[model samples]
Target: MYIESFVEYNYIGEIAGLLLSGLLLFVMLYVRPKKTLLFKYIFNGTILSIVAILFQISIIKVANNPDQYYNKNLFGIQLISFLLVYNGILYCIFSYVNMMSVVRRNQRKEFILMYAVLSIIYVIGIIIEIAASGLYTFTLDGIDIRHFTRYYISAGIVCAVVCFIASALNRREISRITWHAVCLFVPTSLVVLIGQMIYVVKAHYIFSATTYVPIFMIGFLLFHNVPYDELSGTQSIYALDAYLMKNMGKKKIWVVYVILKTLDIENFIKKDIDSLYYGISICRNLENLSPSLRLYKMSDNKFVNILEESDPGKAKLIIQEIRGIFDKSRVDLDVPFNYTIIAGELRSETDTILKVRQFFEFISKRFIDHNSSQFYITKESDYKGFSEHYEISSVIRDIRLRENLDDERIVVYAQPIYSVGTGSFKSAEALMRLKVGDKLISPEVFIPIAESSGAIHMLTCIILNKVCRAIGSFSEYYDFDAISINCSSKELSMENLNRDFMEIIERYDIDPSKIRLEVTETAMFENYERANKNMESLSSEGIQFYLDDFGTGYSSLERVMNCPFKTIKFDKTLLYKSLHDDRMNDILSYMIEVFKKNGFITLIEGVEDESQKTYSVDRGFDYIQGYLYAKPTPIEEVKKFFNRKSSF
Candidate 1:
């Protein structure tokens, strides 16, 4: 009789097996399995494929009735060996598939029952085979049958049980394709069932040939059909900015005007871009909640929600309630959520782009600087603090974007920096002031808002362009002393910082030494290595650094080691509190002394009162800056102050 084998069997089953094997191998290769364990799965599947061929060969031998042609001894050896191999292959398939099934579902009760049943039957079979072996002298009609019976099958069953448990427990962490193989293993297990049906060795080839249905189906499922993405399981999100800008032109981008409440949004949602799209989806639902409302994720952790330009107050109420959903959902929520937030409201629709950025920036700044304090917009009717001023800032944002010029919206103001010991002006700190209509606004009012909205860089360029021009106007009046421009720590971390600064410095025809960069402790320490490298590069080229706001934030040894600033600028709070606090004076004294010993110059900020100025002079501070010297004045005032040394 002819035998069925991949080697000998020419049935549809064998052809499908070969084709499927080739496809699976391609997938394994495509997955780029870099790890050794993944290769082990490949090796195991290969071993199973080889066994199918071997089983086919054994069937042909058994069907020939070899004892009639050859010796009975040869027939017995062949017969027993084939039985053992058949059982071995069956056990392997059963164990592999069963474990895969168990792992995927993870029902311990069901697993235990399955294991018990499989265990009992196989254990009995193994015992019968063991007892009939020659060692015990037991035989069937005085002939031993133990070798042909059960020891290997029992061991095989035990191994299968163990593998099943391990695979079931680890389904998720494994690769999707591996899990595919794991889940479909149930059908692949027909090898064992077929072997069991054809218990006699003579039918092994036929069973192997007919068993490709499950194999073909599993192969189809593994490569051709699956829900997960073949690569990253999610799409890229960097296109978001471009997408919004391209789709919604400046006029249609009206979402910036709606003022939402404080609701913390995670910058990077746990899932990928597709997952983050859900936040936009929920925001889109706002339109239905109020037909004119518009929403989109402006940037990471920042969303722009707009209402009608004609009716901003009506829009604000609707948006406020929508934001309340986030806050209300925080407790025992149906979904995993975080409600911490700080929001900035923009009143002008023209400032749509800038306003969205500012909302995120405002919150980010609180996170970046204020140690998790929340900045919220209280109602104009409820609280009269900075509501009107905040609205004015929005007006300024729209103006800045609209002009796109070397001058407009932002005007230059300078505050004289004086030598404390001599009480003579040394330089002027260039302050950027945004003007909208009849109102003149300080950087303190709009600069922070600019930084929060990611428009700080744009503001910086405006200020630098103005500062350079402002300096050009004053260049002939005095020898160049440094003009310090306030830069965001976030901006420092932006792309090509050194190149950007260099270009600005070169364009202004300003000496690098005349520009002293100031950074707060929080900004300096946030990304110390990048900061250090940037500072070190600038410092090497003759620029200097002043550590702004010492004695605030996580002030530690790391700041001292990492920050290479040439000057230490004391925070206003510390100097203000120093007058009343004896211990605080000691702390400030130690801080100043350490900085002094390091050869860094000290400039104490916020010398608003005589006592504070007297304190800085007595404390050996090299310079002092604040309203005590002068409130930030017009450029002409700064020129006049620096031109006349004894102006104080």
Candidate 2:
């Protein structure tokens, strides 16, 4: 008989395969990465594989037992057990494919239906197998194992076909890493099919291919373990890049970029609140916007939402909803949150990754420029703005690399400040200008970009050196007492700012008193302790610190009094407002009187005409600066205004 001719049990290969599978199971339980959905499925599948292998070994042992009772009931029990193990493996493959393809919550029904179909097929195949093989002899030698082999092969083929069709239909939605992992299962299924077919032909004991299930699962775990942000419960930037690479240009989509600034996590902690919970809550809210929207936490405070929607109006409405959520949260939550939400539809089919990244960079620039919430970037001008930002960032990077100051890429201009007491322009503010080919880019355009790119420090150093050089060389030809260089918040917060500034001054052999550093109230407050230390150290070296842009920021007169400042420069907006309202004029006069009484020199800038200059001088302003006296000009042009007397 066929059973008598069959080779002896392949105990060596079977035991080795079981040991390997057991080892993989141990690793899966203890050595896996984060427990993402995919990881859990693969882990469970591994457990099932180990169980099936043990059952297969037990069946082989029973078949080889010389004293075993071989009855129809026992045969039926073994066959059913074999069927359960085979079907369980098939279900594992189907679940993995379904998880990859059907990500939307609403599409879960489809996944259940697909699994139900596989289950129905298995039930029908089992019924037919049992009905067709009824009334078989009770002896093991009389039974044909080919009947069960046929059922196993048929089920494997059905599973392979279903998984392949599902993967093909949603190939674009699945990431490249996931797609490769899914494809690996195809060959694994084939191994099982071909191995079983060979067993039917030769009637010989062969190593069970179920052993490879754990190996395949290990490969799956390694390939599909996606990193995610624990706080927000969203995938990390790497997953976002993979998703964008796969889906971009395949369909129209909108990207909503969210940035949360000024989180004040320490403050929240002091109040016994979990600040990270807010981040997670925000992700949950945005995810609720659409079933298909995929959210990724790019960093601690930045999130990206990919929406597979084609309608621009719908996208805008979604953006508005995001804005509303933030606005409401700001008022309703105990901790006030600062958020900027920018959304735009990705129209270009090509260069999707580059374009999306550029848009994000642009959003960052806008956040810095305005420092406000609620931005919608959907127009052509917005894209052009991103292009311009990219170009300016490139230019700033190029300028940072150049060593020679005479390369003319970075130019210094001076706007003369009129001294009311001296009746002449004794000091000039040194401003930076960038010359790209023949076009000169405005400081407003490139300064923010420079700061964002971390090139502002270098730019500040270059400008300071040039200003010191100008004061040393041009002081003899031009009669200016000092040149004021603008210092940014980033520059003031530097630990070595005083050292770097003094080094430049000494290199040019100029008096530290010959240079005045103008810092805005905002800059001073950004990192108050650091800025104050740097300012005090620099002031002790005779480089006077002037509080620029007063009354335009979080102005605290008490805070100002604590700092060592020689002059207070009121912003032009205050001067403009004082001219229009009598109350404002009175308030400005009182402010100027208060500062003068505090023994501080007061300067009112933006004096456009004689009336404005006279108004400032009469109000006890020690200095006046604006376009009326002299616009910002090249160093050569500034020499003409040095000794010129003010009309006021």
Highest TM-score model number: 2
RMSD to truth, every model: 13.8, 9.1
Per-residue CA lDDT of model 2 for 363-382, tens digit only, reads 66646656556566567777
Scanning candidate 2 in windows of ten residues, the lowest lDDT window is 135-144
lDDT for each of the candidates? 0.55, 0.72
Off by over 4 Å in 1: 1-405, 421-423, 476-480, 643-648
TM-score, candidate 1, is 0.46
Please give, for residues 1-648, the per-residue lDDT of candidate 1 as tens digits.
222222222234445554555565566556553232123333355455545545434434433333434344554455445444444444434433443332222454675566567656654664565456421122222222223423443344354446545656664433344445555553345345345334423422333423433443353343223321112121112233444445444333333322223233443243343334344334434444665554433334444444444455665566566666555443323334443343333434213444345434433443443433243543444223344445765665675576454756778888888886565787777877877677777777777667655667777777776776667666666644778887788877665877877787788686778777777778866777787788888888887887777778676855665567777788889887888999998988988888788788888878887988888889999988889788888765577776533332
Model 2 off-target regions past 4 Å? 1-3, 8-34, 37-207, 210-223, 226-352, 360-377, 401-407, 644-648
Candidate 2 positional error at 74, Å? 21
Candidate 2 local Cα displacement, residue 76, angstroms: 19
Task: Assess the local accuracy of residue 242 in candidate 1 as a C-alpha lDDT between 0 and 100.
Answer: 44
